[model samples]
Target: MSRATATATGFIAVLLWALLALFTVGSSPTPPLLLNTLCFGIGGIVGLIWAWATGSVPQMRTVPLRVYAFGALGLFAYHLLYFSALRLAPAAEAGLIAYLWPLLIVVFSGLLPSETLKAGHVIGAILGFSGAALIISGGGAGLSTEYLPGYLLALLAAFTWAGYSVLSRLVGSAPTASVAVFCIATSLLSFPLHLMFEETVFPTTALGWASIAGLGLGPVGFAFYVWDIGCKHGDIQLLGTSSYAAPLLSTLVLILAGIAAPSMTLLWATLLITGGAGVAARASFSSN
Candidate 1:
């Protein structure tokens, strides 16, 4: 890709993911019971559109019980934690805090024989955690004791996501596009979970549906599509740095729209979290 094209695509990535997060903030409290499921429900439809746009899409297998099971499990837990966090805390809080998963994965990576932490990785992890602490504190004791549970829940989101990211690597040999199949499988699974857990399966409005579609398509659907392309064609360094830009963008959009009030404090946290992720990615990149 030309420099111009890469730059343009990068902008799209920044905008799409950030915008999706803002939507999550705005739509969560008012939305359908299974907010996350609704998002992915919309996402599955968008995934198909993207597939058709590219060319003929691959048909997913119905016999792969293991793949479907894993898919379902990942989506189910991620949504549960994600929506719960949104309800429990501010949108900016939940979004920025969730980025901590990069550091969590790095710390855990040291346990695996395949990954070894370097001096820089350790330093980055510490800095990242400290940065998050600062943001939570925010100038003069912005940390409400009430906010603790939401923070912990966001951390759980990070942990669940980190585990999923690592588990995903084990299956990296599969076709990149096949992840879409996994997502559809996730949707199939999510409906049942929503049925059991939510006690209802309904959204409030077209806007809520739109929000769900945005998540389904962008974060879960189109985001993956772009990511598959990125892995094939993007610079690892660019991907590392740019991945962190999402939360900042999301927070900014929310604040501007009067849905969330954020600060440059988010920038500090973004640095630590994204920096840690970059370190981990580089560490993994070097081992290969």
Candidate 2:
């Protein structure tokens, strides 16, 4: 794909991710690990079906096992750390820390071959981070020493995701169909974790089951595939900076769903995140 096309594909993931919070909220009472299992399982199955239909199943055999291992471990580790962080720390604080992946992606992309760390990319990333920080923190008093472990875990989660995304480019030759295996492996790993840690609670409502399906089909499923394409061929720095829009769009989704009310904080966040993305886009155009 052309860089522009790949970048657009990657941004679709961000759009899908905007619905993540809403779907997760709707799928209430399902423990995180269990939810992870179900969603990944569904995503994996659908991906496999697509691979088969497109005759990409054979291409999967050409992919190195180590690549599959990396993809699976990356996905599992990220969720594991993120869930643990939220369980141990305040959600707001933990979330803010975990959300650092986007900025990290922008920074880390600088190290990639042929990529330059432009001033606009850095400035835009900072602006995006500032906006995300506002939405996540809600102007609350910041982290406490008491939750140090949780904060650390959250930070690790951020690094895990950022590293995964950037390193994905190194394995750009891997077939996108391999992501199905990653999803399946992640689901299998979550099974043991869920069995050990969480009580089984199936979705009791239609909305809950529908929400889980929505997640599997959109955010957790196709999002990853497109993201792989973007990271491999797109403007990684611009993609990273624009990812900040996820939170802003997510809040807007919540408001539309009547789950959240509009506020000044939301307004400011919208401006900062949107403007940051605009700046990043302009920089990307200049570089191109």
Candidate 3:
């Protein structure tokens, strides 16, 4: 694909991810563990089928075991923490906090060989963290002691995803195959946890089923493959900077879904986060 097409694809993937909070809203009849199990299980099956159709199945075995191990653990941890946090705190707050992965990516990317940390990146990181702080202080139903654990989980989700993204760049496997492996591994790991700690509760309504399907097909599934392509072939700086839009879009989605409402704090947080991303993007391009 052309750079423009690849970049657009990347943005579309992120936008689809924004809908995750919307789909998962309200008290789930399904436990988080089982929800993840079903979602990733379905997604993994789809991914495997896709990989087979695209003749990427053979490539799966060619990948290093270390890559598979990291991908599985990272993906598993990210979703586990993210879904758990959503149950504990308001989705908007948890999402914004979890969205810190982009900023973390910017920082961690600097650690790669031949990459340099620039002043704009530093400034952008500061601004981004400031926005995150603002959100934590005022974003959701208000930060309280009750939500502390959720907040920490969201932060850990961010960290896990950042590390995953960075490590993905080092892996030489076909992205689709790798993602399929990750999904299957996560599902397998979730099985024991689900059996041990949570009862299976299937979706009771059509809307709930639809939400599960959407999560499996889009955000947790095909989007990962598209993102891998984007990162490999798209305008890296643009993708990096525009990633901040994911949280903003996700917040808007929640508002429209009646899961959240617009507020001054969210507006201010948007400005800070978007501005920070822009600064970092500019610096990244200039450095290149």
Candidate 4:
């Protein structure tokens, strides 16, 4: 794909991801483990079918086991921590904290053999982190010792995803097939987790089922494939910086869904995060 097409695909994938927070908003009758199992199982099947139809099925067996393992573990850990954190803390705060992955990506990208660390990247990361902090505080949930575990889990989720993205860059494989492997691995792994720790509670409402379907078909499934393509073929620095917009877009999704209200604090958060990302992107280009 051309750079422009890859970039557009990346943005579209990010937009799909923005809907994730909304889809996972309310407490569900379904347990997190079971929900993950079902959602990703469906996604895996879909991806497998797509791979088959596109003549990519043969490539699935070609992916390195290490790549499969890392992709699966990373996604599973992220969602596990994220879902648990949502239950333990307020969604807004948890979401903002988890969204720190983008900044972490910029920071960690410097460790790559082909990438260089830069002062502007560090400064931008600081600004972005500050903005995320502001959003968390703006939620008006004062420092309660009660939610400390949740906070830590969300931070870990951010770290885990950042590591996953960085590591994925090193994998030379068919992107769609890799995503299929990821989904299938996550689905299989979640089964034992659900049986061990959770009681299965299937969705009983239309909205609940819809959320599951949306998640399976969009964010959890195709988005991963698109993201892989973008990471491999697109403008890495620009995509890294633009990803800061995901949380802001997620917040807007929540507001539109009536799960959250508009606040001036969010406006300020947007400005800071966007400015920081822009600064980082400029620095990356100059360094290159």
Candidate 5:
């Protein structure tokens, strides 16, 4: 696919992730590991089915074992650190730290071969991060010293994801079908972890179940597949900068659903994120 098209495809994952907070809230009371197992299980099954139908399963055989291992570990490790961080620290602080991934992606993408990191990209990333920080922290940036471990884990989670995204480009030849294996492998890994550490509680209500299904079908499922394509072929810098929209859009989703109220914070976040994306787009256009 064209770079622009692939980048657009990758952005779809960001859009789908906008619903992540809502679905996660709806799927609550279920432990993170169990939720991870269930969501990835559903994602894996659906991905396998789609791959089979589209005759993409054969393509996965040609992908190296290390590629499979890397993809699986990358997905599993990020969630593991994120969940662990939240367990140890306040959600808002931990989430804000974890949300550093996008900014890291923009920075790290600069190191990639043939990719130039322009001043606009850096400025845009900072602007986007400021917007995300406002939303996640509610305009405060205080982090408790007692939660040092969690903060560290959250930082690692950010690096893990950004590294996973940037490194996916190194293994750019891997087929998107291989993400099915990654999801299944992640599910398999999560199952043992859940059994070891978490109680096996299923969702209590229809809405809870629907939420999990929605997460699997969109954010946790197709998002990864398209993201692989984008990271490998699209403008990774632009994708990174645009990802700040996920949190902004997520909050808007919550507001629209009546789960949250509109605020000045949201309004300012909207402008910062929009302007940041616009600046990054201008930079990308100039480069092309």
Candidate 6:
């Protein structure tokens, strides 16, 4: 896909994730655990199909199973923390705070052999982190107590994502299958956890299925794979930086769906974030 198209796809994936989170709010019959598990289970299947569709899975022959094994481990650990964070935090808060991973990627990427920190990178990181902080803490102004736990969870999610973002780069050229295989494996890991904590499986509901499909196909299955591919060929900071756009699109979807309302403060905060993301994307890709 072209850069614009891929970016749009990524943004849409994040928006879908946000929507899934919103749908979970007033669910009647399904518990969050089973619903989440079903979503991931379905996502694993979708990722497999998507990798096949894009010819990413077949590329595995060129990459060693050992490296792919590492990729799988990274993917599993990342999802474990991501899901746990969601259970602990609010969607908007977790989503916004977790947006920091791109900046984290830059910081970590600097330690890599060829990566360099440009002035744009530093400036962009500040703007991005500040904007994300504002959104999570409350309207880009100050922090609030009620949302504290959510902010922490989101931060942890960012850490998990950043770690994977960095480590995936080390795997170098591993086909998309590595991530897909790991996603499927990690998804299975969570199912047992779900069963252990929950009483019963979720009944089949259209809304329930819809949320599962969205989470799996859009975010977990597709986006994660796309991200891994980018990590394979592109600068992690660039791909991660462009991710700031996801929350902007996601928050807009939330507003349009009446799941959440927008405010002047949030608008400004988004400006900072999206602005930083643009700068960072441009800088990271310049070397390409």
Best by TM-score: 3
Of 3 and 4, the candidate ahead on TM-score is: 3
Judged by whole-model lDDT over C-alpha atoms, candidate 3 comes out at: 0.80
Off by over 4 Å in 3: 1-3, 139-143, 171-173
CA lDDT, every prediction? 0.65, 0.77, 0.80, 0.77, 0.76, 0.63
For model 1, the run of ten residues with the poorest summed lDDT: 56-65
lDDT of each residue in 1-288, candidate 5, tens digit only: 799999999999998877765676677667778878888888899889889988999999999988999888998888778766765654444555676676666667766888888888788777866775665564565534577777678779888998998897787567878889999999999999899999898888999899889888988898888877897899987786678666567667877887666667666766665566556556655786
For candidate 4, lDDT tens digit of each residue in 191-247?
998999988787788888888888888888888877767877887666666687887
- Where does the lowest 10-residue lDDT sum fall in candidate 2? 135-144
RMSD of each: 3.6, 4.0, 2.3, 2.4, 3.9, 4.2
Q: Please provide, for model 6 over 1-288, each residue's C-alpha lDDT reduced to its tens digit, 9 standing for 90 to 100.
A: 565555554444444544544544333345555554665566678777777887776675677776766765665665555554555555555555666666677666666888887777778778877877776667745676676776676677677777776776676655566566666666666667678886775546777556556666756666666655555455445445556667677667667867566777667666776677666656766765
Tell me how far the alpha carbon of residue 128 in candidate 3 is from the true structure, in angstroms, after superposition. 1.7
Q: Who is ahead in lDDT, 2 or 6? A: 2
Poorest 10 consecutive residues of model 4 by lDDT? 135-144
Task: Tell me the number of clashing residue pairs for each predicted model.
Answer: 1, 0, 0, 0, 0, 1
Angstrom error of the Cα, residue 284, model 4: value is: 1.9
Instruction: Write down the lDDT that model 6 would get.
Output: 0.63
Candidate 5: Cα lDDT at 133: 64
Model 2 has an lDDT value of 0.77
The TM-score that candidate 3 achieves is: 0.91
